[model samples]
Target: MDIDKIRNSAGSMKIADLKEGDQITGMVTVGEDLYMIANNSVHQIKLADSIDPKRIDPTVPNLQQKIFGKGSDSILVSRTMIFAHEICKGDVFEDSFNKEKIMNISIDLLRCVIDMDECFNIIKLYNKDAMSSVDDRRSVDLSMKLPSLGEKAINGETFFRKLSMSYLLILRTFWAAHNKEVDKIFDRTLDFVSKNYRDDERFIKFIQQLVEFSRMFKDWRNLIEHPKRGEYFKIIDYTYAGNNKISRPMFEVVSKKYPQEPVDLEVNMEKLIDLTISNYESLLCFLCERKLKEIAGYTFKVMEIPLKMRRYPHVRYGIALPTTKGPAPLG
Candidate 1:
């Protein structure tokens, strides 16, 4: 395989027909061994080895050294939980921390991505057509599959809560990255962005749009979390009347901001996931464009394994630094 040719390409491509000294980028799993491809060289690692020095065999020619880099600089990668997007992960602009607050910014982003993934999977699994339709007046009893209508409603509410929390986490962590004081409340972050970044119209507008886009979701989650009032989440299956009135399966809730709203579990949650991802990418681009200029010249690479045949420990993604000499063919 011409590994270098597909480095810049998008999506997962089938990787095969690799010779002993093939120049490859990204990690490839063949049989039981893990191939760490970096800087035009392939380092084959045994499945049984615990990353010991003796277990790393430099498959490239004349490179008998270990597979680790000597650089002291740590690279931060903001990657999608799944390998769906191009330019999976790259460096971020931030400083070292002495006083601790929340988790690492990377882990926070990682959880956000993971929460998106969980919501996506739930939507995929539970997005089934209603078993039967009910009359407008008669009450109908229900008995369905393992994940019944009640379970589906619970799943939807849980997903909205998780996604809303993720949205707030992104805002808080992004704010904490720039300032010394950490703001835990969502309202505080919004106030800070509006007050501090008033001069930067572009930044303020983007943040405002994101907040407005996700406001419905946050309000819905609030009802679920704090049900001290009379608000309750309701689920409705397929319903049809004689005069051509129909309503499909939906999660219904009375919004504190607006009137009673019925949200489609499949459609609305997926839209939220897509928007969250786009919002994060836009924020990352804004930060890099505004703060870090010198780190722009560096080329970036990610370690990817095919999602179809994914293994344990979830080898997320890693950065590859260039070496002094080009990789030689294995003799």
Candidate 2:
């Protein structure tokens, strides 16, 4: 059960042969418990309790004094420290917990949203510029040379697609928000998920699948953002047969497991805003209602399940609405 063996093992391991300064490697459990495999000997160690302070004296200078810092029982273990230990022990790769990777993906998603917003703003500005130019013939020449409004509309559509993809990734990643209103909405969504789907393993697995999707989404985003010269714009249709992508699998698994849930998801900006408001209102009702238990229970059902079950598409291959060419395109 060496480090490689531990790394390859699918399940938990237990070994009792580890000694001080003898490096071990494996996945760290949620509670800081390390599961390691060294030379075919699998073991578990509670990291916080296993390390002897005296062992740190020579290897880590001034460690004991630092541990006793100003009334603290022990020095707090930073996430970086934990990750470093995991990597050094060969339990995790350097890229496993890279903040830059996560941030890059997140920023890529955010940029899509920002780009969409900018595209709309640009359209508005172009309209204003056009109107102003009509009154001033001096500037008419400049306006005539500008790109056609059709081009701008095409760019807007392209940006909207990018934004929709990024928004899906954001929902998948479960990123926290800097905006208070967004934070509230996120918290409410989590609460809804917990209340209605806690017992549903399929839903839980759906969330776990998002980690892989986030990576793919980032790759697709990079392709769109920095495409090679002469490369044509093509949407990666996850719904195509034999595609077997994360999003497709997610849809399949959830739809099969929860037949009542909606299969298609529409990205309506206004509806999302409304849903955020509704989430907050429901949360408030749950907290302040007179019949606390009854109200809270019913509110959870109404807020979480009804809309989801009604609007989500049942099949993965159905055409999305509000498409480029109306009903025919949607079909």
**Worst 10 contiguous positions by lDDT, candidate 1:** 69-78
User: Over the stretch 23-103, how does candidate 2's per-residue lDDT look in tens digits?
Assistant: 443333433333343322334444322343334322221111111111111011111122212212211112223333333
Q: Estimate TM-scores for all models.
A: 0.52, 0.25
Best by TM-score: 1
Off by over 4 Å in 2: 1-105, 134-148, 175-331
- Model 1 lDDT, residue 317, Cα: 26
Clashing pairs in 1: none
Could you give candidate 1's per-residue lDDT for residues 1-331 as a string of tens digits? 5433333245442323344445444553433445454432235455323333343433322222223321011111123222211222233334532112223343455455555556556656654433332233334454222224555556666776777776776665455456455544556657877888788988988877666645666776777777646675555554443354454456777765733577555676677676776676566445433443234575433333344423222333232333354211111
Q: Cα lDDT for residue 187, model 1?
A: 61
